[model samples]
Target chain A: MSLNDPVDDETLLEVRDLQKHFKVDEGLISSLLRAMTGSESDYVHAVDGVTFDLKRGETLGLAGESGCGKTTTGMSLVKLHEATDGSIRFRGTDLTDANEEEMVQFRQNAQMIFQDPFESLNPRMTVYDTIAEPLRIHDIRNETARVRRALEFAELQPPDQYFDQYPHELSGGQRQRVAIARALVLDPDFIVADEPVSMLDVSLRAGVLSLMERMTEEFDLSVVYISHDLSLLRHMCDRLAIMYMGKIVEKGPTEDVIEHPQHPYTRSLINAVPVPDPGVGRERVELAGEVGDAIDVPSGCRFHGRCSEYIGDICETEDPPLEAKADFDGSQKVACHLYEPAEGVDSTRVDDVTDTTAPDDSAASAND
Target chain B: MATQDEPSIFADLDDSTVDESEEQVNRWKRNLRLWRETLGEQWRMLTNDLLVKLAMVTMAFFMAVAIFAPFIAPHQPLNRQYETDAELIIADWVDPMFIDSESVYVLGTTAEGFDIFSQLIYGSRAALLVGLLAAVFTAGIGTLVGLTAGYYGGKIDDTLMRIVDFLYGMPLLPTVIILVALLGPSLWNIIFAIIVLQWRSTARVIRSQALSLRERPFVKAAQVAGASDWHIISRHLAPNVLPMSFLYGAFAIAWAILAEAGVSFIGLGDPNRVSWGTMLQSSRAYAALDFGVWWWFVPPGICIGLVVISGFLIGRGYEEITNPELR
Candidate 1:
């Protein structure tokens, strides 16, 4: 992977070790009390360290369980939540260091589609005002023309018909479409769609998803689709990154990751999805334990407590780095101790390393 | 829900409503139209409540009486008739058509020989002036403070809320009494006192509301759209919190009127101005109730009650509209 290169001609968004931590304290009084007592203030490590590259006109899916920091990563990419550490470069401009003018320029070229269409739109503003707001903010001319075009693209036909209507007057599908129109009104280069169709009815999901696909292709937009639904990600994304507790455990082509998940966490996540066909019976790989709180995250790997393939003290004591294995092509990377770092090794398979260390799979499972 | 096939009701109408040549004019017209729509919706909600309707009617009567006080009153409020040596008597038998000096008193003459009917009519002006000014200032200051504090929380919220909490400790009547004493008795001073003390409630209420609304996804969406903090507060947050502030404005108006009355009844009213409270104060000095001079004190007292009840009715109706959970 071109991880060493900060800027590439084709890479639209390069996020390196992004982290966003939220204070766990209630209010200022608690902060003052904590200060007076000389105790460490606790924090929710929401997005600890995530790294990804989004190529121009590419759709990257961030698949994770709830609270796994997929949404935070998406938000940080758009500079909605300022990353606590690391860097986010959008078209070679460092978003973290962007000043007022640069920030404004960045905002004009980037947009976000929130999960809840009902809440994402200003209830007081009409459809036209909501879509026209970005144009007004940027002082762009011909706002009526741009807003009408966006509405028409969103499939709200005869845009003038819906201009006066409020979000309350629209159905779930229509409301989501309005939100899409608002995001697209800016003619953004990059878009962060945080579960855009999750709130809509299942029947309405396909239409909105197809609209988004059309938008990505039509605008040549680099997009990040954040969702816990693997099926949705598999359908929309070209490249998929599976996240577990604020870290991407595996990343590869969507088909490769879905068909052959290397990391135990990724395998368990894929297995959790129910198969619609009753004829094709597959063994369900249920993992132990619940998702840990972000406050007191487990030491080594975050998924160690939940992984069924718990490998002894090595898994418990050492943090695993995301590295490509010799068995697979260099494009796929997995973050598990089962796969030794293949950077210096030559043609070393995963089982060859596990045989010398653990002797047997059952023995490693017994260590749990 | 509107679909592609089903066009809106006004689809065929031309853009004649907002065809202004200038951008500022168009924006202003759009805002005015939005306000009209919001107000029309609110009016529909208020009209459903009979008490609110009655309250509006009562307020209209007082406002009309205040606006046309000079035309409505038979004599100047300050015109005291010492030529005839009038005694305090109920003017029930006095003929209003005959403008004789002795029968000129409509409701009755005070011991000071001031026409009670004239005083009562003109008193509405002072009551309304104090109420409207105090309410507007209080609501304006409170809403601004609340939106600021709630939008930029942390230290700002702490400091603003602490100040509000400190002010909330002030007892309304005593604070106004002391304030008027220091400022010297005047209509403006009473209004100033009421505004200073009354705005805290509105600030606290609106702050709580803005705090919750600040977390809504729409607010985040606005931020992502590169809206400045000021624009977000004024354009987005202000409209959302305004209806609640108006509800508080109604309460503030009622409070201001009553506070002015309380301050005036204790002999701190502007001596040059004739308010309902000043009339009550004067009647008390002559023991109008004790002497069976009901018209001297009863009219001003009833006017105060009517205005306060109307305020409560309007507030109740507005509360139901703003928070449908209450309905």
Candidate 2:
């Protein structure tokens, strides 16, 4: 319901200042080498300062290019990756601070569906064993009835046909359905789907997406759909959040964000989607800039180095707080120096509706 | 063609055009082709390599010799039938299919005038038993330890791996011989010794294999599904880890058999039981290497070589099947 943990009673899950940092070179030899080099600041800031909320039965898309930490954000919510810092209140219970036992209890309520269906399902297990796994783990229904119900839930009709079948015997779509069945069989309240349809064939993508959309409504499940594909996100998500360098840059209602992307990074992401028809050519904003390394995130706004609206030193020195703008709907929030009232800029005079085109001279393009 | 309307390209053709009476004649050809394709894939997977087939055949031969020793053997392994010159008498090697004289020893006699052929046959059962049982227990212990170590990882993995390393660094065969000698020979003592030494190799191999399997997303998926540690190891990790562990387990059988021979040759084996090793040890003129007495040592020695060779073959076949990189 809210991207930055807004004060609202309807919000079912609220994440604030979430971060998942991993230490590099932990092995003895690697540590020795690192110690000699004095590279103590060897932390991979995988997900930093990410905040959001999901209302009950809402589908919020966490969109980002690869290595932008959308997957990490989704994973951290389910306590798959231990959060380095921050808090996640799932309907008022703190998920970020929970220990292993507590997380196991959290796991029953929240589940994750991974990207690669082929890699996610155990190759050795039969379809029944695979789907029956979660049910057995949580000490749920009778094995026979549970497996059949899960099989039916995932749209694998006539459970007897699939009961003894192994993953290698099935097609990619069926395998993904098995993965979904494994996730959904437990009947969790929240689901984090990390590029669930990305690895699927283009033709099969719709079927899987529609099945998930149908599951969200059928189960009344609050879902976080993480994907790099904006078009896919547009179809699947009610609200969308675009991530850049381990932080959410812009987020709002899917239609509102697609129409009026407040952040330059969000606009560039929307512009990057290749038009299907060869005949039609829209005015495209080509983002020719070095994507910043997440490890060495730029001091100010991480996007300032490549921002199309190349403002003064304020963009480089100060990080902009996410604030509501009047030009678009009041609900959408963006964190950019150009949109918000900041040092050295009169916010009222700034053109809020114009295209923030990349300048002709490429000097301001990310040199990092 | 339809009148004015086009016939759909996607429409199925009439069966008469593709499936005529000629199909009956070609049925055998079709069946043969299908069989060949299936066999081709299987052959590449398990038997295309000459060594694997040789291993399989060798194992089969040894198994048959052990299992049917009583029916096949002409002379009793422990009985000496000679009235005089019992040590010097060598039975003329007779064809196995046609042995008329019970007095004529096939493949000559041992130092005690007991038939070498009979001893070789009786000896095979012990070799096979020690080799296989040792292999089974070794792999079982190794897989269990490796699974726990890999799945639980951290202090448990470190402690178990350290124990493995401690065992690994020892002079294995000599230590085993000394231990077996102390424990005293019988089939079980030798087997116990072999298992203790052999399992480390298997455990190390399986542990490394399981370590890799632990990181696979399927394992993590199970972890997230709230599957307990035991469940994840047994269901998700164990299946992928099984083949490699079996590969090492198979090879361990060969080594265990060889080690049994070595211990038995050192006079540490139960002399009451005749094995390939004991036969080698008890052979007349075996240590002296005398002339015109080739039969004294050659049969049992050859049997030992064959058994070890068979074990290697079987082990390697398992390796080829289990290893993905080789495939």
Worst 10 residues of 1 chain A by lDDT: A350-359
lDDT of 1 at A163: 89
| Candidate 2 lDDT for residue A146 | 52
Tens-digit lDDT track of model 1 for B112-218: 77788899999999999998899899999999999999999989999999999999999999999999999999999999999999889889988998999888888
Give per-residue CA lDDT, model 1, range A1-368, as digits (tens).
23223545477777877889998866769889988999988989998777777887888899988889999888888777889998888778898887888888888889999999999998999999999998889887656767888899899999999988999999999999999999888778889999999888999999999999998887777889999899999999888999888888898778889998888899889999988998988878998889987998787767888887877776765566665654554356776777645555322332121112322232223211
Please tell me the interface RMSD, in Å, for model 1. 8.8
Docking class of 1: acceptable
Where does candidate 2 stray beyond 4 Å? A1-10, A26-41, A97-104, A277-283, A326-330, A341-368, B1-109, B112-118, B154-189, B266-273, B284-289, B323-327
What lDDT tens digits, residue by residue, belong to model 2 across residues B92-137?
3332223445545566655555777788889999999998898889
TM-score of each: 0.90, 0.79
What is the CA-based DockQ of model 1? Answer: 0.35
Report DockQ per prediction, comma-separated. 0.35, 0.20
